[model samples]
Target: MHKHSYIFITFLSIIGLLVSSCQQQTAQSDEPQQTATPKDSTEQLVLLLSPDQMKTIDLDTTSLKQTTIRKNMLLMGKVSVSPTHLTSLSSVVGGHIKTLHIIPGQRFSKGQVLATIADMQVIQLQQDYLTAKADWTSVKENFERQQTLNAQQATSDKNLQLARAEFQKLNATVHALEQKLRLLHIDPTTLQADNIRQTIQIYAPFSGTVNKVFVNTGQYVTPTDIICELIDPRGFILQLNTFEKNLPGLQNGQKIAAYTNDNPKAKSTATIINRVSSLDDDGAGIIYATLDQPNPTWVTGTYVNADVAVNNYIVNSLPQRSVVSFENKQYVFVKTGESSFQLHAVDIGESSDGRVEIRNPAQLADMPIVQKGAYDLLMAMKNKPEE
Candidate 1:
């Protein structure tokens, strides 16, 4: 009986030790859980501040100053042939192209021969013209003699009148022959029976580079056929298309800067020489803006960008972050005084870079606008009531 009692006591002592260890572990777990509750509560109670409340917290202000403002509008444009420099060459007579005196890209002066055309019809016309000139000369001599004889009564009045009429008719025939020869590309002074030519020489009407040559040696050509195209490099214009909404600010003589994609660093100032009133079929519009100077780097058909200056308006300007939008309305926090802020409505205008035009009379010129810590102040103002 004594041995069994001793064994029972040993078992009870072991159970008591295990229970104490379990209680110590439970207390340790509860202590950390209790500390975490306060931390979670503090995290949930976040504060949000309005613009006015933000301005009340140690805000800064500055005096406003008047400054010149300029408005700039950017537009895309392209290089095009100036209307003044574009010319088309057409053949005056139908014939086989005998020879091309000038190739494409060759420069020629006014009245210079560019090509020659050989036509059977031109040969016949030249022959007729030569014969008419000879006949007209003979008739003129006879008429002069008849006039002298009529004054002396050496010849009958009827005979004198007949000679005079014949002379006038021959003169008209000579004029017609000259015109026909000219149309056939024959110089009147170079016309003679032995020197008569069938090939008509086409002359350059203007001094410019030949941009296009449509005919080769031995090619057949007609009077209506386009022979060549002349382009004067000296005459160049920048053609730019702009939006219709920007039309009101655009006018002839307005200054603009043009730059090309290839040479962006090189800029040229041009004037608005023309504006088209029509809009394109698409909702997108177009306006013609011409440049003042001819830039050699500006190639025809190359695209460019243009910046045009428009009218300037006065407004209170501030950093872009100073004003924030909420619920479709714009608001700015104005510093009423030290440790005070008031919400003010403002009309905004043109914005560029980091600055925005603020149209408000609340004297924002010298006031310190919340630039860096606006969002933080906003949160503070929202939680001020709860605090």
Candidate 2:
């Protein structure tokens, strides 16, 4: 019985010792856990682990990378030209279309003849110009002879004055006729009574492609008649329609790859030149870009697609999986201590090609980030209390 009593006393002492150890553990639990900052509201979200735990979690660490990111935009619109590129060519004089040297949709260079007119008026003008010149020569000789006689007192002042007046009038008439001959594409210096012809060729004023032909062979054309409608061959532009939401992404000098629905594989490079401030009824804006090489075969008003890479910039970034969303905010895991990681709120920018941009990279510049096991750390942190 004495032995049994001694054994019971020893069992009570052991139970008291266990109770004291439990009290000490409860006191420590009331204090801060892990070696972290003082912001318990956010800093307390930490994973305090050992090397074995890290290996079990399969964590991989990395640093921020300086790389470029851009958002791709697919724009819808059509290829068009400025009003300055379009022109209406008309016959300079009334005549019959003797011969037509051009057809619709044909490209022409400056000074290339489009048609010729058989106008008898051209021959009459040339003949009148030559006759006026001959009359001017006779009047000039008489004026000189009268001036010489007046200096010698052999002619009256009235006679000298009359000769001068006739000379001036005939010279003015000769000048007017010469200009008329030149207007008919006849160089007055190269024209003579022997070389006078009734045919005058109409030439292109600018290098362009004919859009419409208004006259044919044996057709009568007047001064008000349009010969053809022409368009500048190299003045094609892209008029891409974009919404207000996409305005911030577009800017001058950015490049675009434009293509048509019929031939999407054939891409034409273009550069943005203007962003229209005015909006359409649907609040859509215009993005004007000039093509590097204008395709002459492309008809005006052709519907086209523009692929623009916008807001391109170099920034600190990480793999897409390296960052995770929590509580409606973006965050990343940064290694604060050996086997310890803290959740950091990061400001994200543009994302591209499986990579995400970190706008506030300075916050994590000196810290190692959990690159591969970010989602794992997030799960562990969320369930830490439950465990």
Candidate 3:
């Protein structure tokens, strides 16, 4: 009986010890661990700020609200001159450039002399014209005399016929030479041996700024060579490349807002003049638009951003300053709790009147956003915690 009681007492003691050990472990597990593991980088970004810091930054919150906004297709393009407004200048006849009055960026009007070319061919052409005129006059006089003789029966029929043929031949030569002289801008009626010129002037066919000069003074150029390039700034148009799928949304006479990448505040309005139906190798289509009011300051080849209206509807939006851009992704802060904000990635659209349109409105509906101090929250969440 004594052995039995001893064994039973020992078993009871062991059970009490086991229960005590388990209770100790339960207490330890219930307490917070000293070392906390950091979350994965792709997980939700969070920021914890002190009350004083939040007050100092004057953190403000705004809720999502519905407002009328236009759906716009953001397009990237460049300024281009119309084909008809641009031209390449060249001489009709080959010659040595005697003088050049055109310099890069110089503006010239139609019929203005751009340069002068000198060659012996021009003088020779004038001389031939004078000689032909003299010969024609002599032959014509002889033909008249023969006609009178034929009527009087004083000359043989063969002689009269020969004189007539010779006169006709000389007349044709005179007419051909006269036209040649006119082509060189020489008036055949006023041209004489002493007054013939060895140079021909090149005139501007239209008014525009000289963009480039190929030939310098005293250089020989052929008719096919390009003398210079000219462009009219007034004919500047905006050219944009869009996908072939967007063709149905584009049309003639549609309004477009254009601005350069360097200066977004300096915006200009334009109207769609054309939309090419053909698709390029990449399935891209070209859009051409004319400036509503042309400006001389708009230079050709300048990169521009255009907002083409696609549709209009009510959207939730926020102030431009409420959003932050980091790592090429746009973000905004949502006030999850007092002194705590959650960073959320958002897809944004066109901005106007200091407000930006949010593409995903339902995600942020009825939620308070960090409007005033969003950047401060972004820095706190993005930066690593201090040691």
Residues 1-387, model 3: lDDT tens digits: 999999999999999999999999999999987988996884547777887777777788897776655567888899999988888888778899999999998878888999999988888888888988988888999999999999999999999999999999889999988887776678899988889888998888777789899999999999899999999777889989899756766788999999977778888999999887689799998889988877666678888999888654456789888899978999888898888877888999777667888888888888889898888777766674643
- Model 3 lDDT at residue 73: 83
Tens digits of per-residue lDDT for model 2 on 1-387?
A: 999999999999999999999999999999987885564565556778766667788778888999868867799998888777878877667899998888887889999998899887878888889888888999999999999999999999999999999999999999988887777788988887789898999888788788889888998888899888888857788899999867877888989999988899999999999987799889888889988987866877889998888766566899888898999999999898878888899998778898888879888886788888899888878877743
lDDT of 1 by residue, 242-317 (tens): 6665676778788989897778888888887777667787645555555666675555777898878776534457
Prediction 2 TM-score vs. true: 0.62
Q: Write down the RMSD of candidate 1 (Cα, Å).
A: 9.8
**Could you arrange the candidates by lDDT from highest to lowest?**
2, 3, 1
lDDT of 1 at 148: 96
Worst lDDT run of 10 residues, candidate 2, spans 36-45
User: Which prediction has the highest lDDT against the true structure?
Assistant: 2
Clashes of each: 18, 0, 0
In order, candidate lDDTs are 0.72, 0.86, 0.85
- Superposition-based RMSD of candidate 2 using all C-alpha atoms, in angstroms: 16.1
